[model samples]
Target: MQIEGSVAFVTGANRGLGRAFVQALQSRGATKVYAGVRNPDRLTLSGVVPMRFDLTEPASIAAAAQHCRDVTLLINNAALGKVNVGALDTAFIDLSREMFETNFYGTVRSCQAFAPAIVGNRPSAIMNVLSDATWFARPMVSAYSATKSAAWSYTNALRVELRETDTQVVGLHVGFIDTDMARDIDAVKSSPDFVAHVALDGLARGDEEVLADEQSRLVKRTLSTEDGYYLDPPPLV
Candidate 1:
């Protein structure tokens, strides 16, 4: 799908990679971008319209879908992580639940709510910002990784389900990005602007999957190891 003049709804657009997505789409000549955020006031982006949305709330998702009826592309960019690393510990179970609720259930809700909008526009698309952790385990972010893995699986199923409709579903997998989310992590991170550029280009070119950085490419190449190296479960201890 051509992004120029296409309407897009990007969640978590108040900052970080989400903010970059808004700018990237605008730079590509998107007609209108609905920057969805839980706290709309935090978004002061001049060219985009701010739409109030808390992804974990089904009603809020529906409201945003209704509010952005012209949206041809839905970008699932929001995620939740724990304050501490050991999410497998009983003490962090609540955070684990919240992570899944926000990262997995919330994504599904957004997809359902926006399907009509995308279908109405016909031949539109959905871009899910997944992570390389979907394949490789990140011990410190075990719970967060689990959530993204679920999203990765769901995106695969969704791609097949939407094939007949010609509504492109692009799954984007990237390593750590130079955003607040990866600020303290030592991993080499890509700039959010670069990730957005590659992702949008992949979406327009009808690419089923986009590995945005070298780390993501490495993970994909290693996924077929005989020992299932890339699929290892996060260490609990």
Candidate 2:
């Protein structure tokens, strides 16, 4: 899908990678961009329409889908990640459930709600923002990782289901990014602008999956190796 003259709707567009997506889409000549957010007041970006979209709320999702019927590119970029120290503890379980609510089920809801519009348009696309956590687990972020894994599986399934349609389903995975979500993590983080550029480029080229950084590419390569990264949970260092 060419970004030029396309109408896009991006969730969590107020900040982070979502914001980068909005900017990139505009820069690439998207005719219109809908910035989906829980609170429309928070959207300060110009040249994009702000819509009230809360992924956890069915009504909000439905409303946004109804309002943005012209959208050809659906960017499911909103997600939740809360770190928990103990993977087996009740706190971890609760947080994991919350993460899944946003990362997994939310993506599903958005796809279902927007399918009609996307399918109505030819050569449309859905870009799901995933993570390296989908392929590996860290003790501190086990819950978040599990949610991403579920999302990855869902993205795969959705891709196969939509194979006959004009809509393309694409999954994007990357390691830590230079965003508020990784503010406390002291590590090499990819620039959100660069990741967004790679993602859109992949979509235009009809790539099914895009690894936005070296870490993500490395992790994907190791998935088939003996004693792969997913086999053992890594320490939180």
Per-prediction TM-score:
0.94, 0.97
RMSD per prediction, one decimal?
Answer: 2.3, 1.1
The global C-alpha lDDT for each of the candidates, from Candidate 1 onward, is 0.87, 0.92
Per-residue lDDT of model 2, residues 38-144, tens digit only: 99986799999999999899899999999899999999999997788766767987888888899999999999999999989868999899999899888788899
Tell me model 1's lDDT, rounded to 2 decimals. Answer: 0.87
Candidate 2 wrong stretches, greater than 4 Å? 232-236
Question: Model 2, residue 185: what's the lDDT?
Answer: 86
Identify the runs in model 1 with alpha carbons over 4 angstroms from their true place.
83-88, 227-237
TM-score of 1: 0.94
Looking at model 1, residue 51 earns an lDDT score of: 94
